[model samples]
Target: MKGFSAFLGKEVKEQLRNYKFLILGIVFAIVGLLSPLSSKFLPVLLESLVDDNITILLEDPTYIDSWIQFFSNTNQISIIVLLLLFSPILSKEYEKGSLVHMVTKGLSRQSIVLAKGTLLFFCWTVAYWMSGLITWGYTHYYFSDSTAEGLFLPLFSLYSFGLLLLAVLLLGAVLFNSAFVPLLTVGGFVIVSFLADIVPVIHEWNPLQLATRNTEILVLQEGDRLLAQAMGVSYFICIGLVILSIVIFRRKNIA
Candidate 1:
């Protein structure tokens, strides 16, 4: 327990010293502010660009539009930022051969991987949800008629999906020596999940559904059984990936 605590502390310090948290907070803050601001003012921005003689018909924006921008930005750009920021986590240690010192000093590889993953997960969850909360608060303030039902389910599901991504990154970082390995692994998984979306049977089981089908869950009058099922599967996959990463790292020849 002492070793694990030290490792966790070291991971947190590295994140702070390297400015990972600062970068994540800045990116998420921008996304949070932009989503709602865009929802409220996009029509005016579009109108300003129109030809003088032409008038474009535009409906008043709703809270849903704010959420639409929120999910779109978060699921696309915010997540990509997370992946890129964390891709080097393990790769950098391996590349510099700094992990050798830790491994030889009796710092278990399992603890290192677990500590890093836990720290990253904690940081990502805070940033991700802080962005969403700010957007929600602003959207609600601007749009009085909007009420999001079953909001917790979707938000929790999205958070879980992010953890699953981090787990896969740990596995990829362990399996390959290059810094590009994590990015390539994540991208390939995304592509495979995209393909899975088209398959009728696999759609419900795929983790991709957690991100993509969120709007559907939000819009529908009732919750989705498949969302719940996918959440369960994703949670299990995250645990499995973390364990696999530990096993892989245990056997890796660091010398």
Candidate 2:
């Protein structure tokens, strides 16, 4: 426990020194700010671009529109940024030959993987909630009459999906040496999951649905059971990946 805590502290400092926190903070904050602002002004912006002779009718943007922007931005750009930021996590340690010294100094390989995962998960949680809170606050202010329903389930599902992605990245890092390998692994998994979504038999239980269908879950009450199933599957997969990462890292030759 002490070793794990020490390594976790080191991971946190490394993230701060490397400006990971700064970059993620800025990106997610921008996403939060843009979601509500775009939803509120997009129609007006489009209307102004039209010639006086042309008439364009757009429905009044609502809180749902703000959430749509939120989900779209987080599901796409935010996840990409997260992947790029952390892709080199283990690879860089390998390249620098740092893990060898750390292990020799009495740190366990399991501790290293666990510490990295813990810190990354904490950072993601903070950034994700910051973005969501900003969106929530702005959405409420702009759409005062809007009432939020079924909010917690979708938010929880999205957060779980993010954790699952991080776990997969960790497993990829352990299984492959190159930084790009992990990125490709994670990307390929996502692509395959998306393609699998087209199959009716797998659609309801798909992990990708946790991310792609977040807005639907928030708005519709009918899909509650399916969303619960997806969330459960995602969390289970995340745990499995973390365990696999530990097992693979144990057998991996760092020297």
Candidate 3:
């Protein structure tokens, strides 16, 4: 962990130089705006697009609808883009043999993992919150007659899931030297989680609950109980992944 602060600062500088912040901010901001706008207008657009004889009775869009769109967009759009964006973080360096100079210069492999992990979480937290805040503001403007009760936990659950993803991505980056390998690692992890959730007994402790149960969390339903448990598991697994990644990277042949 020596020089962790310096390494993290370097990571931030590189990200800024590459316009990573600009790209992430703009993308998440657009996604946030789209959530409320699409939720409010999609029903109207559908009605207009349908055939005149077609009788499609859709419910009026509400704050709940906007929030639903928010979560969906965050998951399907924002998170996917995020994983793709950072998928090459470590693996690309391996391909370039760029990390060898740093390692030869007394940089700890653990520092690389720690710094990159910190950078990943920091970027995700900021970008995700920006998106959520934007969605919240517009959702309120469009659905003025809405309650703010029970919002924090549900939103937090989604953020926690993003952390879980970064951890898996970090481990993938350490274990493999290809950018695509990390994505496949994350994909495999998600697929297994989704499959495991099919069992009622397993669903209670499954970390995927944090990502999939936002509406349930908002309602203080049985899922609320399960979400809390899942968040704990998610963090536990995230830590384990970080540790495992560091251990693997320390021994990995990055060249």
TM-score per model over all chains: 0.95, 0.96, 0.94
Scored by lDDT, model 2 comes in at: 0.87
Residue-by-residue lDDT tens digits, candidate 1, 1-255: 676789899888888899988999999999998998999999999999999899899999988888889889988889889988888888778778888998788888888888888877888889999998898889888889778676766677677888888888888988988887888998888788898789877887877778887677777745567877788889999999999989989999776
Q: Give the alpha carbon lDDT tens digit for every residue of 1-255 in model 3.
A: 558888888889988998988988998999999998998999889989999999998888888888788889899989998998899888768877889988998888898899999999999999999998998899889887656788888898899999999999999988888888899999999999999989998898999988888976676623446777888899999999999998888888876
Question: Whose TM-score is greatest here?
Answer: 2
Q: How well does candidate 2 score on lDDT at residue 23?
A: 99
Clashing pairs in 2: none
Q: Which tens-of-lDDT digit does each residue in 1-255 have in candidate 2? A: 788999888888888899999999999999998999999999989988999999988888989889889989998888889989998889988988999999999999999999989877988899999999998889999987556677767777788899989988888888888989999999889999999989987898898888888788777834676777788888889999999899889889997
By TM-score, highest first, what's the ranking?
Answer: 2, 1, 3
How far does residue 62 in candidate 1 sit from its true spot (Å)? 0.4
The local distance difference test score of each candidate is 0.85, 0.87, 0.88
Clash list (residue pairs), candidate 3: none
Model 1 lDDT vs. the true structure? 0.85
In model 3, where do residues sit more than 4 Å from their true spots?
221-223
* Model 1 error, position 172 (Å): 0.8
Q: Candidate 1 has what TM-score?
A: 0.95
